[model samples]
Target: MTNTHIKTLTAAILFVPLLAFAAAPGSTDSIETRHGRVDVIADADATHLLVAGKKIATLGVGSASLFRITSAAEREYIIVQGSRPGLHCHYSYRLLALSDSGPKVSKEFGECLDLGGAGMSGAEPVVHLNSRVDPEAGVETYQWQGDDVNLVFESPTLCGATGFVAQKNAAPVRAPLASRVKGSGRLQFLSAPDAGCAMPGVFVVPGDKVTATLASAAFVYASYTNPKSGRKVQGWVPRERLSDL
Candidate 1:
């Protein structure tokens, strides 16, 4: 998946075959979902999907292709996919929850070499995300439990071979909140938000106050004195992982 984001970017740059949708000339447009109305707004000349009037996600320029509404367990889901056509079509998907607050992104697959079979359902409703990389392929099935999403199942293996199923691993445990010496609780911690990015040599525990040294659209690079080892460490983590204190 190293070229995932690159492929998405390239698709955005390429000329897209326009779909059959009527446009109202304005800064924003609205579409109805099972949960609520989603408005696509223009911000700084870029297109963004707004839920509850809040910017939930940005739509790649010229990359908008299809919108699919999926129903499971009496709830609704909105799927927006961008694909680049060729011998090996490159594509990416964003899974959103249709909720009272609007739509919230649950999973983002930057760009897949080959993607298929996004539908899945059960008592709780699961969304299947699959990708194939040459001879190796994998599937990650996720379920939205309340407002949080959980990766309940995963299988990876050589193409056309039987794959072993495994439960998704839990997030790393953090130190107690009482030990926090610095940094606001709103600050997010991450494990690489994008492909090919380096993860921290060790995970940052909650109690450690880390200094953010760099910022990007998707991640922040932070440094902190490790409480366990007393050594200084730094790495890139996703901006979405941190919540308000």
Candidate 2:
């Protein structure tokens, strides 16, 4: 063969093996866990969950995406997000725990766009998932408890702007006996503590006097007495909208 042809042939030989061993597009690498490596293998028909090369579970029939893998002292937790066939916007997640018997579903949360990101909060790792269609469904927060995942908190706001759970269990403190609405516009008084709930037509405008009794992370339970009707309306209002008088 000519030297030019020989060099091209040699290069082709070197490249063939690299192609054979190359990772396929859309294939995810194995993730290390406390037990072993975990993998999500997808095909045209189904998506499979594997541990140490052994098939553990079938995640779904369509698309499945790995959200997170968290390890604790006893076991490893895997969060997988998937959508139903033909419903791209409707998504859900499954929490799987790795055990000696195999990997098993710990918990399942449905009807979310995409579960919020996972991260560390102090010493504990936590995951937050937000609702896709229902704003009132709010956000669900989870944390690892040994091998199992626990839903520790649920926020009333879409962005999870509340720390109510942390303050929920704390010793009760004295709040201002009375306060006045301080915002420029009318503040919605929700029937429930959640801001996402439909307004019941109850509203408090600036300079309106209200009594603050109970308080949550982002809202406060207020009793407002209408001066004209002499009627008392009790509901939850945004905490920031009230000022101590």
Best by lDDT: 2
lDDT, candidate 1, residue 200? 29
User: Per-residue lDDT for 63-167 in model 1, tens only?
Assistant: 433344334445555555544445365666565667554556765554653433333232233434565564245555455667656766555521101011101
Mind sharing the TM-score for model 2? 0.47
Q: Where does candidate 2 clash, by residue pair?
A: none
The candidate maximizing TM-score is 2
How accurate locally, in lDDT, is each candidate?
0.43, 0.56
Per-residue lDDT, model 1, residue 197, is: 30
Q: Report the Cα lDDT for residue 111, model 1.
A: 61
Q: Estimate each model's TM-score.
A: 0.39, 0.47
Model 1 worst lDDT run, 10 consecutive residues: 158-167
C-alpha RMSD of candidate 1: 17.1
C-alpha RMSD for every candidate? 17.1, 16.5
